[model samples]
Target chain A: MAAIILLGLNHNTAPVELRECIAFSEEDTELALEELHERTEFKEILLLSTCNRVELLLVTDDRETCVAEAKQFLAEHNRVPLDDVEPALYVHEGADAIRHVFRVASSLDSMMVGEPQILGQIKSAYRTATQKKTSGVILNRLLHRAFFVAKRVRSETGIGDHAVSISYAAIELGRKIFGTLEGKEVLLVGAGEMAELAVENLIRHHAGTIWVANRTFERGLELATRFGGRAIRLEEIPESLQHVDIIIGSTGATDLVITSDHVRAIMRRRKNRPLFFIDIAVPRDIDPAINRLTNCYVYDIDDLKEIIDENIEDRNREAIKGERIVEEATIRFSQWCDSLAVVPTIVALRRKMEDIIDEQIDKTLGGLKHFSETDREAFDRMKQALINKMLHDPTMFLKSNGCLGDRSLYLDVTRRMFNLDNER
Target chain B: MENLRYLIILLYLASTVSYLLYLFIQKDGFHRAGIYLLIAGVGIHSAEILYATVSSGQLPATNLYDALSIAAWAIALVFLVIQFRYKIRILGIFAAPLAAMVTILSTRLPETPIPAQNIFNSIWFIIHIVSVFIGDAALALACGVGLLYLLQEHAIKAKKRGFFYSRLPSLELLDTTGYACIVVGFTMLTIGLITGFVYAKAIWGRFWSWDPKEVWSGITWILYAVLLHERLTVGWRGRRAAIMAIVGFCVVLFTFFGVNFFMKGHHGQFTTF
Candidate 1:
């Protein structure tokens, strides 16, 4: 049976100096993959090189030799002795390797648990390895399975919800209310860097027709021009409120810029359309009372912070669930791998039985040379039926229980008992 | 023929289940399956109606069962067209079950034969019934969309961010679509009332009567007219307009079935108003 092996140094195992030394640049990764494929005996390989870690995954017939050779290659590439790198490397073989890959892809084993960037980083690594043609069928299936498992973990658990930052949380809430940012109108109430970051999020989500309002006209125009949006005076905000669907307020104003009465009046002019306000200013640009209105919703800085805290707590709890999913998927993948190992033994057993039946049939037909064509056909059918009935139980047993325990032992006993040729 | 009708009803029920799954699953593949099943159901229903019309030598909208079957068919037809055009697939979670419920109710009602009358012979009466049933179906759809708008609004205001909040269309989209359905329904209702007046004059020698069906339909029409008028002139939309749309549809329901079932009217003999 082929083995899966994972060899790597991560943030926990290696210091920063070792990680930097072990890491491969993007251009170097292509050359390294080519050289590794040409020099190493590992049948299939994938190299994942990220800032926090550099991992090498392999599928090979001899796991021990593959690991030794990979460690030597890493030390040689970094111009270090094998003994110098040995203490920093962690090795996982067989089922443990599969579980580790799944954990890595799902971000469970990241420096920061539930961090979203690690999944994307791993995906890029997989893509590069695929393009290099270093990863073949076994690695391809294994990596694709990891991607699916990661996706399942993301959707089933809220690990990626509630953006960790204030501006991102505002964008997340905006999406919850608006469904999609496409064709939505946004009004940025300040020209601060935080507000600019929120605008970046909005643009990333494809928000439509942004309007920038600030106390200073030139500042607002500068920010608006950078984002390809129009600029309006702060005094003109109420008039523009009727057209925009979302308001991101982060101005330096001391007093309230948007009051409950102002929102009420705007609601009437806007025909009671849904309006969302994100007040990130320290003194609160929009009144809290505005949220009580029918179609208007407001979230101040404290509320956003509270939401972010709650989201972090929710994600911590959800990570437990995600771990369980990865565990189940790893076991399923292992079982499928075990099943693959028994297929050849079952095929050989059936072929051996067929060969014996054919020999006996030849002898029987030779003795009945004077029989008519119909009598000869009847004799051949009887021989075939006997062979089928005889082999059915053994065939079922090898297929069903062959992969369960001591697979080599079962194959050995079957070979010796049946006197079958063990060609492979 | 009865078995075929039952089979069509079962298909509608299956389509309803598929649509609910589509909404919950939120998969494009599941949604396409739902739409195909609904289209197949509509096709079977049309065949059933065609078969009935050919064999009985009468219009398919002649009695209570036939009228209801046609109404259910019209509702699914209009919903499918709207879903295709607007791409609001979640609407089927409401529309499909409604069509299935109407079909199921039609099966339970006593499908008694109607006695022949001079009014039934007129082409004007047939046109009036068909137009009125189509209008009622459209209004029913408007009610469903109006409910969706309220639910979405409530989710936003209450901060109950969850499944329905994500699945439903934007408040603006639902509000405008509901308004459009009401407008089209109101137009058809006006034509229905006018033709009913003309048919009444031809059969009974009178254009106006204080019959409960006529009075209730008049009230329903006035209610929707005020809704449209407020929306267009006063710029009334969003929550207030959505509520009024629901209220208007309720009044329409009373005019369609409540008046006929409870009060004495010349129109009740036809089993629909």
Candidate 2:
């Protein structure tokens, strides 16, 4: 039976300094994987190295010696001392290893739980492993199952649906109001860092032409040039409102920059198209009263924070559901691994029985050739049925849960009794 | 034939249950199950109506039972089309129950016997009934979309992030869907009223009637027309549009049911119990 082993260090176990020293670059990872496959007893090897975590998944017959060798190899490859690396390294074997892989792939084990980038990183790592031909049947099946479990967790739960950051919350809220930000015009007010970040996210959503308004003309022009948008004086914001559908306000202004009166007058001219105001300023750049206007929405910094906080809670709750999916997938994959153990014994026993039956049938039929072809055909059928009936109970016994506790014991006894090993 | 009607009701009921489950559980499987069940129900209901019309050599909606059945079928059919177009599966929470309720109500009411005068054979009458029922179905969907718009809008404005915020579609989608439904409904209603006038002229020897149904249909038409006019000229959209779509549907319901049940008119004779 092959033992599944996972040896790794993650953000949770090691500090950034230690992790950086131990991490492998893409080229280094491929080289390390090849060296490990050649030098170690590991039959299948996959090395996953991301900024936050580095994990080595291996399938081997000897667990103890292979794990020690892997640790030593990691120390030598990264030029780090074995004493420093050993403290941060964690090891998982058997079903626990499977569960760990599932959890990691699904983002439950991420430093920031439910972040989506980890899955992509793991996918790329798996792609490299497959490209190098270092991953075999067990590792390929395990990684594929991990990807499947990740997808199932994504669809079945809201783990990745909520936005935990301030800028992301703005985009999320914009989506809730506009359905799709595509082709929606955006106006950036005062050129604050937060507002620029929100604009960056909006541009990614394919938001149409951006307009920048600032207190100073030069700064506004520079910011507009950076975004490939037009720069306008602060007074032009009201007139610009006619075309702009989204306004992101993050200024140092103490007073409200966009009063409800300015928006009310422009709304009719704009034909009552919906306007979304994201106020990221501390004292509030847009008026709270604007939120009450028809076809207008205003969300200030505090409101965005509240949404992010609520979403974080939602993600935490959904992560619990995700963990359950991971658990179920882990149990299923482990059962498949367990069933793999019995296959060789079953095949060897069947082959041995068939060989003995074939030898007996040939000798008996050779002597009875003088009788008739019909008699020979009847004899062949009887011998086939005898093999099936004779091997049925032992095969079932080896495969069934009745021998699950001592499955290896049953396999060993059956192999010795049939003398299956020597026949092979 | 009656067993087929009962089966349709059962299918609609199952669809309604599935949609309600999807609303609470937010599961894709329940949503898919609801859609398939609704399609089946609509399919069988269409066949039943076609069978009735073929057997009688006239439109099936000559009586109240057949009219309600056709109305329910039209609602489900229109909803299915909208669902496919918009991918707004959550709207099924409302559309399915409404379809199921109308279908069940159709079976409970006693169906009036067909009139002997053969007025139902008029092509104008058939066109009018088909157009009116389909129009009402579109209006009904608009009402459902309107309700969803208000729910999502309130959730966003209030910043509550409650049960409906994530479950419902975006406010803009709901608003746009409502607008599309109203446009289609308003157009069909206009055609229905025109054909009805033609039918009235042929049978009653006059193009205009002061009958309760006629008066109410005219009122419903004017209401939607004003809404459409304002939407085009004055930019009355979003919340106002959603509210108007809902209010127009109320007038549509009154024209459809209230006029027939409470007031006596020439149209009542066709649908009389």
Candidate 3:
């Protein structure tokens, strides 16, 4: 293969200490990328430097020479034996190298099953390398194609969607009953860690004004004011209940702070507008019985967790769909890599054949008295047409089936049929 | 055809047993067998349907009963495909019996020769059928996760690793997928309901007639729509969302088989009309 191969170590192969030993800071990564690209064998090179990995996707045809140089560079920097780290490295050549890049960019090989951060990370690495002019044709094509596949996986599957978190679900419930939470006021009751996290989530959703109410009032007041909402007394439950669209009660009251009658009375006061109630307390602060009322939605902590669970399940359900897409895109990327090999071969063959035919026809017709210029031109055109018609089937077949592992037969047949070996 | 149906039922039974065994043993063999069994069942189920179509000289889209049967099979087929693809063995813990139950119940539905007409002429029928199956499959998966969430929460409360606690995906992955299923299923169901409404307007001269099926379906749609909007816009998700998803599927179950059996609605005469 004319392509450059890469060899590198990552989290999968070695522990953190070993990885840190071979690692370079972000500044040095740009410098190393520049240095590698300047070498003759390096048509392109990019260093993917992350906490878990520091892989160099380098382009060079001389695999053994590149590995030897890279090993020397790392050993001199680390002051460690090159033999000890030899087992930690993996080499990928040609199509395998291209497939590896796609998988890395898509995050199918990630520790977290469907994490999305890797794509952005890869893009940044590609950008940094490009900025330093360390990337050439091969790496440029691979990185750009990797980004496209990553985008497709994101859109086609729910892998990146849904945080599947209890905190996120608490916020989702708040948005459900209330159409727009932009200007809506939320009354957050209690200061439990889980309850606080849910409130943090709701705040992220831009729940406009938040009021914190706790037994002590002071404990709740501190967290509330930070989010730009006021603190209310526990006794002001009824008054606060009417003003807020969401009542997230997480008090450890061991009884209901918001009862059915409290909700009924509030529903009457608010002109029967929908109220979202999430009682994220073990003792249950809001009465579950209140969910029986129309336009009044009540869900306990378990329900919120269940919502997150359901989201997780749904993502798992679509996991295969995502995998199939990633796999297909992987092969598609490899095919692109393979076709690039054929271009040069085809260019060389066409030139050599045309030269031989031109010289032979010219020499044969040179000393003929009856041979006119127009006749020779017509003969050349006929010869060229015959060459195209004869070579079309085998050339097309070889290029199309390049991935089938039987290309030698086509090359051999082409040389024998054309008898172009005699010139060399 | 009857023999093929028996084979399909046998596969269902085998899968149910394997899944139940999996709940206890958590063996890879049972998991693999469960997949094969389900695939075999679906393959036979598909062949049976194709055979029925040719032998009965009726198009698969002709009758309401056949449509429900086809819809049920579709649910099973989609779940099986995803199961085989994802190696999500825990889903079979619920999906198998649910598929078997739908298949069995579909048989109970009275079969009638489809009314002679170009019923499949309009594209609405295909849309309605497809959405029903997709929604049904989503609800099946949602119910499975919701059930697991309840069990896991129960186990967490009890501090015990019940059989379910071992097999289900992490509480996070489950809750996320459950919420997504509700969203996807709800979108499909909304399409189903809209198509039903359009089809209703074409046949009955109104978008809705306040039929029991119509009323209950509208209620189901609103409930799930609330669930989805809450998850996406407001950030309501987790075990609580899962419980709602399960509850929502109960309504879906009632919508699918119960309404035709117990409730009076326009859906009852949909085949004849």
Candidate 4:
């Protein structure tokens, strides 16, 4: 029988500071994974390191040995005490471990459930393990099945629909005003992390025209270069604003940059087509009074935050569907594990019984039963019937009850009562 | 013949009631009832047209109002035919209102015997009327789908979750349907216009009179023509095509009723004359 052990921490278990400590830089994650695999007890290991989680997928024989090895591996790498890591860690074994892996890979365990990137992360890790030749029969099968299950959940349910992050919320808000983002222009303000994320969300939605504007022009250039967008300086924003249908502002300015006057001028040039302005800045970079203008819609940080929070609630509503999928996969995996566990015992018992039957039948018929043809035929029939009747009940009972872990005690009792021996 | 005419109106009213029921509560009983109501209405409409033609020795398109009402009924009947073929039950969401409006108005018009007009004698009138109704039917179907597409798309992008997640088709499928309808509609419309040219030359003694109805009809044709070209050649699907289809239908409705209601032209007396 095989067992899996999962040990990881996520947004729920750890503070941001702690989870950030173990977080791998994009360039460093592969090397880190290779180093983590050096533990003797961690035979087949996959490292699922993401922004919100750092899970170790291990296929090991002994639960306690594997757990200790995982804790030690993390402690040594981060230079943290093992005791300090305990409170922030979770340890799930056997059926629980398999379910956790599926959930994590499917993004059901993500801070934002159904984020869609975790499945790719899981696939990358699986490929790395395959390249290293560290994966065996069980893990290879488990992971391949996990991909299908992940796809099933996505195709059958709307768990992955909608955006939950501040960036995704901005993109969604833009879509509401625009009705569609195809070929629509987006003016991203101040090249911040939020702006970069907004760019990601917009690009994914097929918004083609992206303009990045920042106070320090290089920062804008850097983000624009990454996202294939046009970079603009703050002074050039008014000219940029006239062409763009959407504007996302999250700058470090102490005062407002876009006033009612600037907006009125932009609206006049565009002939009153709809414009969506999102202000993600703290202390508000865009003038709040501009919302009074017709055809100009403005949402400040709090307003955008409310939408993001609502997305989180929407995710919770869909999680009920995701949970149903995970629960079904868990029960099936557990049954397979239990059935696998009783296989050796069943094989050993059958081999022992056959040997005893062979010895007695040979001794009785090999020489002493060679009297007449009818007598010899009768002896062979009796010998076969006894063996058939002997093995039927035990085999049937072992397979079904074995899957539930209840057959182990009975097998032990049978072994003692029959005096089953390996030397035979 | 009289019974069939009355039956057409009855079936149209039944369809309207059932569609309203479907809108309020989307259950199997209402959906099935709507489907049966539409099928029955189409049958009655067809029977009434067939009986009127057979009894009076009159072509279906005898006068302007007779032609207008017949064209509207043909559009509804064609939509119902497609619905029966595809079993596309969602079409009732838009089709019922169209059918009821056409049938109810058909009843209100003067029941005076209309002698066959000289314009209705030309072969172009048949093609023009058939093509126009065919295109109108496709546009009506597209509007039905556009409504569903927006509903599904909104539910998804809003992060709001529930049964809508399961009921709606993918955005890709909706896009394909929208593009397909516009293409079919545009082809029929082009033929309708070409035939209208021949019919105008035959009866009105001119190739381009620029009647207000004709002007608006040409504008309507150009709107959908550009939409079709954009969708097929430029890959305009989903949102843009949806918006265009909706706008195009508004133009069609105005061409059907607005010009008839307000403007005085060859098409103004569409239902009264």
Candidate 5:
């Protein structure tokens, strides 16, 4: 196995104060990458510096020495003493390091397990490393495989589905109803914080028309202008409801601001088009009875929380699937590494056999001076057949089982028998 | 010729299995291989038909066996062309099995060819048979697509969000393609009916006969006409249009097979089965 050294401190292993101290700035990272290439014996190095974690991934021939040197480099670069930083550092070597890289790229180890930003952060780290000439063939293949595993985790499981926050839940429910928010209209019944949050999420999903109505006209105008929507008076809510498909209400009101009668009239004017209501206020602003009307749906604060809770649970379940995918990809990548390791031996053995056959054929043809063209062809065919039959079993066995376990002794004996080591 | 027909059946079977694999796996490799296999089957099928036609000195669609075989071939050919035009690869999952099933049924039919001196051997006879078979093939494909639409709709409505939900094409694409199939099928059926009327007048000295095959074909044609009319005028779409397509294909199948195999008619009486 190749030597992989991963030494870093994340939010899980270190306090925020220590993480901030250990984090690499852009200049610090570029200098460290350059210094490691110039001074250290490590073959490849990548520094991933984000707010939540600062990790150094190094590939070298000697795992123990490289892991120690990488930690010292981190300590010296961050201006921290070696003793204090060593206790905070977490180290993974070889296959564990590979798995860590995969899990990190797939976001399985993030503070938010299924968050999507970590993959982009890792990609940028890899891009910087590649641009600096710090990552070569091995690290390049490993990073690309990590990216692929992350993509597989994204598609094969519903890890990125559903919403983890209340406002996002409201938007996700809107998506479930309309399949997309691209052409749907949203009505913000008040300028409350949760309603504003919902509006932000709706805008992110590309909702078309937005109407903000509130009891206070100036406050409504401020919120509407902030979100690029129309500011309507409180009395105009009913008329706006006829045109909007979704209503997010979070006003601070004692009584229901939107009644079943108001919605019934709007429903009639809208000609029975579907309507969705998300009320996040205490003593909800919309009538609960309006939910029973045809093509009408109402979800209050508790319901939105329930959906978020379910979504978190769904993400946890999906994370388990993601872990399995990571393990599967890790095994595949390990096998590829193994095959790469044995390729040199396989090539040397085949060449040795071919060279011996070619020498034997040359000597025999030199001795047969009176042979006809057909006779010469027959002799060449016989020599080729002898060579193929002799090398077939050994070639198949070594190519298939060479990477199984410690078989260096067998490779050494074969090299000696063929005088390959003597040539070198 | 018989051996070549058998080889064609084997190739069709292989293509059908490959298409089934493509559907279940949803892999591009499986789909590409399935398409290649289907093309191979079509090539062998054309060769077998050509051989039969040359040896008999007539069109291969002279009996129930050959007619059904030609129908299957045309269906696969048209489906291949549509698949290339639209890139609706899942269409083959339905079309391949249909072609295979028709060829299988053709094998089970009697092998006796039509008599040489049959009065229905005119060019009008060839036109009527070819047009009607191609039309029926299109309607059958439409029926298959309609079934796929209903399956996808059911999956979405039930919120299964499973394989079928993700794998099936969009509802709008399926509906539009089904509509296109009906338009082409209906046009060909109109031509087939007109040619049949002309040939009937030339031979039986009448334009309209109360033959079971003719009457049922008229009923099938009228059902399709009503389906098209409703789709154009009343904005029939989605599930309603899908159900109509399936029902129209059912009527077509009854006219093509039930009338020929069970009832007495000028069309059925001529073909030895």
Candidate 6:
């Protein structure tokens, strides 16, 4: 019998330094898949390499030999010593391996449990494995099941609904205020990394007309060019405030970049259109007092962090629901794998019964020389009926017991009683 | 006919239950079920109105009972239109209960018959009653939207992220929908009042009756007119606009019921309590 095996190290088991050392690039993954396919021992293979984890899933008849050979191959391919990498490695076989893959695909095994990028990464890995022709029937079914389970977990549960990062939280808050971000103007108060990240998320929502305001005109222009937006000097922020709906402030200024009075004066010209300010800077580029102004909202770094923290708690609660779905799918998949074992046994038993019955009928016909052609045909028909009737009970018994805990024990007993493996 | 009216009320009550389930459970299935029930209720209610009109050789709103029934039908019909256009299923929480309540109230009132008069037979009176009822329905929805806007605004401004925060829509959408309702209601009210004057002149020999209903209707019209003027000119929107919408709806309610119950009016002949 063939067993599904998984050998991998993730962020939980390995440090970034070690994971990076063994992580395979796309070309390296393709090459490694081809190399692994060259060995007759590995019947099917797939390699999933991402920033946080490196996993190799395989199907093999000889588990011990395959595990040793795969570990050795990993050491040689990445040029890392066995002792240095062996402690970080974890291996799963049979049902454990299937559950691990399901959890990984559903993102329950991620560093951030509800993050969505890992499923796309797994899909790309599966695509590469298919292109290399390293994934066979069992693996193809398993990968597709993984995708289905992942989709079920996403829709049936709220695991991926909330934002757990700073930039995402800012966008979530902005959506609450504006109903939608489409065609809403965004002003990047400085070229700070956090503000830039928030703007990137805003642009993803189709926010219109990006404006970058920096103390230095050239720096602002450079950042604005990247977003296909216009640059403005710091002095012009008050004038630009009339049109812009959202302002993201992450400048390095010690003093406040925007004051309450400035926003107060612009609120009339802006026709009381809502203003959202995301202050990600350390010194707080936007004034806290501006939050009190009508139709104006200000969220600083701490506020964003608070929202993220609350959202993370929500995600954690939702993840419990996802785990239940994963558990149900895993049991269903294992039952399917167990059923695969039942089919060939039933076929072998029927074939054995037919061979014995046919041999006896031929021997009897040869002894009777006066037997008519019609009688011979009737004898052949009786032989088939006899074999079918004899095997029907055993086949039914095996199938009925297929989902039991001692299913393999029953199969072993039946195989022994029938002497079904004598030829092998 | 009475059995059909009972069935309509039952369907409206069922719709109210479904919408309430949707609000608390936040399920799309319940919301869809609510919409279907409301549609069935409105369809039967329309047939009932047509039946009463054909049976009596005049408009159906001859007394408080019939007028309230038509009012409920108008509100449900307008709600169906708004739900189809905006896809704002949350608004059903307000609309379904209000329709159900009005339907129940119509059944509770005693049917009083005035002396047979040619005034009730006038085409102008029919036009006046239909437009006024529909206009009142639209303004009622505006009040509901205004309440939602204030709730959402309070949730956002408080920064507490409470239960209503996620349930209510954004302030901008509520404000825009409220403004649309006001514009539609204002236009229909203007038409109703104009036709009302024509009907009054044909019957009472003058357009300006100084009746309580007429006075209150003028007051309600001017309130909405000012609201529209300010919203268009100075952009009095968001919280302020929401508050004005609610206030204007109160005046409309007073004109619809309060003037008849509290003060004598020429329109009192149309609805006897």
Per-residue lDDT of candidate 1, residues A219-285 (tens digit): 8898889889899998888888889998999988999998887777887777666799988898889
Q: What 10-residue stretch in candidate 2 chain A is worst by lDDT?
A: A403-412
Best prediction by TM-score: 6
Per-prediction tally of clashes: 0, 0, 54, 0, 0, 0
C-alpha lDDT of residue A362 in model 3? 78
Question: lDDT tens digits, residues A1-424, model 2?
Answer: 6789999999999999989988899999999988887854777889999899989999887899999999998889889999999999999999999999999999999877789998999889999989988887778889999999999999889889888889999898889999999999999999777789889998899999999999999998999998888999998999999999999998899999999999999988888989999998888899999999988999988998899888888888999999999889988888667746788777777777778878988886677658687877787788778878987887888778796443555665676677765735
TM-score of 5: 0.67
Q: Each prediction's TM-score against the native?
A: 0.76, 0.82, 0.49, 0.61, 0.67, 0.89
Kindly report which residue stretches of model 3 are placed more than 4 angstroms away from their true locations once superposed.
A1-25, A35-43, A51-54, A65-91, A192-201, A249-261, A279-285, A342-344, A347-424, B1-273
Candidates 4 and 5 compared by TM-score, better number: 5
Residue-wise lDDT of candidate 5 within A1-424, one digit each (tens)? Answer: 3566788988888889889898888878888899998855577889999988999888776777778788888888889999988888889876788899999999899887788999999999998899899886668878999999999999988888877888887766665455568868888887777678788888998998788888889988988888888999988888788889989888888999899999888765675556889889888899988877655678888877776677788889999999999999888766555544445766766677677777877787888788889987787687668767877776676556563432433454466577754545
Could you give candidate 6's per-residue lDDT for residues A1-424 as a string of tens digits?
6688999899999999999999999999999999999987888899999999999999887899999999998888999999888999999998899999999999999999889999999999999999998887678889999999999999988889878889998888888889899999999998767778888888999999999999899999999999989999999999999999999998889999999999999887777888999889889899999988878888889888887888888888888998888889889878656644778778878888888878887887778999899988898788778877887887788778453433555665666678876735
Candidate 6 has which clashing residue pairs, if any?
none
Candidate 5, which segments miss by more than 4 Å at Cα?
A1-4, A11-22, A31-45, A59-88, A102-120, A126-424, B50-58, B270-272
Writing each residue's lDDT as its tens digit, candidate 3 over B162-222 gives 4555456555456655766676688888898899889778767888899888888898999
Model 1 TM-score, all chains together = 0.76
Chain A TM-score per model, please list them: 0.69, 0.79, 0.70, 0.68, 0.77, 0.83
* Per-candidate DockQ vs. reference: 0.32, 0.75, 0.03, 0.11, 0.06, 0.59
Candidate 6 docking quality: incorrect, acceptable, medium or high: medium
The model with the greater DockQ, 3 or 6, is 6
Candidate 5 overall Cα lDDT vs. reference? 0.81
Lowest summed-lDDT stretch of 10 residues in model 3 chain A? A403-412
> Model 5, range B97-187, lDDT digits (tens) per residue?
8888888888888878666665646888878877887889889888988998888766544434456755777665677788888988999
Q: What fnat does each of the candidate structures reach?
A: 0.35, 0.82, 0.00, 0.00, 0.00, 0.40
What TM-score does structure 2 among the candidates reach? 0.82
DockQ, cand. 5? 0.06
